[model samples]
Target: MFLNLLTLGVLSLLEGRFPARRDPGQRPLNMAIWLVNFASASAAPLVMGAVVAFSRRTGLPAFPVDAWPPVLAAAAYIVAMDLGECLFHRAQHAIPVLWRMHSLHHSDPCMNASTTVRHFWGDVLIKALTIWPVAAIAFRPTPSTLAVYVLISLYHYFSHANLAVNYGRWSWVLNSPAYHRIHHSREPQHYGVNFAGLFPIFDVILGSYQVPDVTPQTGLDETPRGLFQALAWPARSTPGRSAAQGVGAALKAPS
Candidate 1:
C-alpha cells in the first residue's frame, strides 16, 4: 500500500519535472475524467478483495502442484492471463452497448496518470463478472498471474501518462504512451486498432495495429457534454450530440 502511494507521488513528480505537458486541472473535461476514475479506483480494491475471498472459500484444488513442474505452471498462468485480457479487450470494442459504458474512460481530453482512473464503475463490474469464470477454474492462481497483472497495470498507468518516453523499435512488442495515444484518438479510423495492453504482438499479428507520430486531438468533438456534461450538464445527451452533428450542423448548433 505504501509502495503504491509512493509510486504515485514519485511518478507524478517525475512527470512534472521531466515534461511540459498540460496538466489535467487546466481542463474541465480531464478533471471530470479523473473524478470518475478516481472514485471507481477507490472501490477497486474492495471489489478485488471480494473476488479474492470468494476464490479462497469456494475454490479448491484436488491435486497440488506437487507433481506439476514449476516452469510449466508459470507458463500456463501467464498464457491464461494474457489470453483473458486480450479477449476482454476485444470484447470491449466488438460489443457496442458495452462500448457506451467504456466511452467514459476514452473520454479523457488528454492522457496522464490520472487517466488510468477514468473508468466507469459499471464497466468494472462487467469486467469482474466476465473474468470470474477463469478465476474459478484456475484451482490455484499462480504467482506469475499476479505478477503479470501488476506489471501490465503499471505499464498502462505509464501509457496513459504524457511522459513522452519511447522504446523505439521495441514499441512493436511493448505498449508505449505514444502507441496508446492513437487508441484514444478522436478520429473514427483509429478506434479498433492498438488493442494489445502490454504487448502489440497480438495487435500486430492480427493486423489491427498502426503507428503514427502525431499526438491525438481528443475529446468527443460531436458532443459538448463530453466528460463534464451528462454527468452534470442539464439535459445534455451524447447520443443526441453524435446524431445531430452528422445530418445538419447549423440546425443543431448550440448558442
Candidate 2:
C-alpha cells in the first residue's frame, strides 16, 4: 500500500509538471470506481492468501528448477504472468459478457494513476482468483517469489498514469504509459489492441500491437451514474443498453 501511494504521489507530481492532456476532467466516475475497488481491497489479502494456498496444492505441472535465484525466478514468473494477462485482457474485449464488466475501467475520461484502481470489483476478484492461480500452479514459485510478482504488478498504477511517457526505443520491451494509454483510447481504431500488461511482445505475437502517433480521447459513450450504479452495472447490463444505462435501470427496478 505504501508503494502504491508512493508511486501515485510521484506520478501525480510528474503529471502536474508535464501533463499529456492539459484539461483532464475531474474524473468523478474514476473516483467512484477507485473507491469501490479500494473498499474491497481490505479483504484482498485474505482472498489472495487462500488462492495462494490452493494454488500451492493444485498438483499442476511445476517448473523443474525449485532452487533458481530469486531474480531469475521472478523474471520467469513475470513472462508467464504477462502472457496469461495478455490472453485474459484480450478475452475481456473479445468476449461480450466480459466486456460489459471490463468496460467500466475504460470509462474514465481523465487518465491518471488512480485510473489503475478504476476496475469493477467482480472483475478484480475474478482475475485475482482465476488468473493468478493458473500462473502460480504452473510456476510453483516460492510464496516469497509470488509476493515479488504482486509488488511488481502494482507498477500497473504507474503505467496507467496520465504522464506522456513512451519509453522511446524500449517501448516494445516494456509497457510504458503511452502504450497502455492507447489501450484505453476511445477511438474505434484503438479498440481491441495493445492487450499486454507488462510486456508488448504478446500483443506483437497475437497481432493486436499498435502505436499511434497522436494522443486520443478516452471513455465510452454512456458512463455510470454514481458509485452504487457502477457497482450494479455488470449484473444489469444488456446487449442494447449501455453498461451504465443497465445499471441505472437496475437501480430503478423493483428489488
Candidate 3:
C-alpha cells in the first residue's frame, strides 16, 4: 500500500512536470473512481481464496516454481502473468460484455497517473474469475514472487501518466507511457493494438503491436458522464439504440 502511494505520488509529480494534456478538472473524477476501486479491492483476497479453494478441491495441478532461485522464479512469474494480462486485455476490447466494464477506464479524456486505477470495481472480480485464476493454476508463484511482481507492476502508474516520455526504438521493449498511450488512443487505426501490460513482446508475437507515433487524443466518443453513470454503464440506455447496437458500438470502439 505504501509502495502504491509512493508510485502515485511520484507519477503525479511527473505528470505535473510534463503533462501530455492539461486538464486539472478531470483529476477529481479520476481520483473518485480510483478511490472506489481501491476500497473495493479489499474483496480481492477473498475472491482469490475461493478460486484457490475450488482449484484444490478439483485437484487442479499447479506448476511448482518454489524450487527455483528467487530471481529466476520471479522472472518466470512475471512473464506468465504478463502473457495472461496481454491476452485478457485483448479480450476486454474484443468481448462486448467485458468492454462494458472496461470502457469506464477509457472514458477519461485526461489520462494521467490517477487513470491507472480508474477502473470499474467489478473488473477485479472479473479478473479474479478469469485470467488471475488461470495464472494461479499455471504458476502457483510464491509470496516473494508475487511481491516482486507487484513492485514491477507499479510501473503501470507511470505508464498511464500524462508525461510525454517515449522510448522511440526501444518502445517495444517495455511498456512506456508513449507505448501505452497508443493503446488508449482515440484514433481508429490504433484500435486493438498494444495490449501488453509489461512486455510488448506479447503484442508483437500476437500481431497487435503498433509503434508509438505522434501522441494522439485519447478516450471514447461516447462516455459515461458521472460516477453513477459509470457504475451503471452496462445497464444504461442509449437514446435511440437497442441493446445489441450498444454492444456492437462498444465492440467497434478502440481499446
- List the global CA lDDT of all models: 0.58, 0.71, 0.76
lDDT of 3 at 119: 83
Q: Compared to the true structure, candidate 2 yields what TM-score?
A: 0.84
Per-model TM against the reference? 0.69, 0.84, 0.89
By summed lDDT, the worst window of 10 consecutive residues in model 2 runs over 246-255
Better of 2 and 3 by lDDT: 3
Expressed as tens digits, the lDDT of each residue in 95-127 for candidate 1 is 555555555556555666656666655666666
Number of the top candidate by lDDT?
Answer: 3
- For candidate 1, give the lDDT: 0.58
Model 2 agreement with the true structure over 1-255: per-residue lDDT tens digits:
778778777887888898877656435676566765875666665676677776567654678647788788878887898898887777676666777887777767766787887788877667767776677666767768768887988879878878788876667788878888887776655666777889887877777777745577776666667788678767764533233322222112111
**Model 2, runs deviating above 4 Å:** 26-29, 42-58, 235-255
Off by over 4 Å in 3: 23-25, 239-255
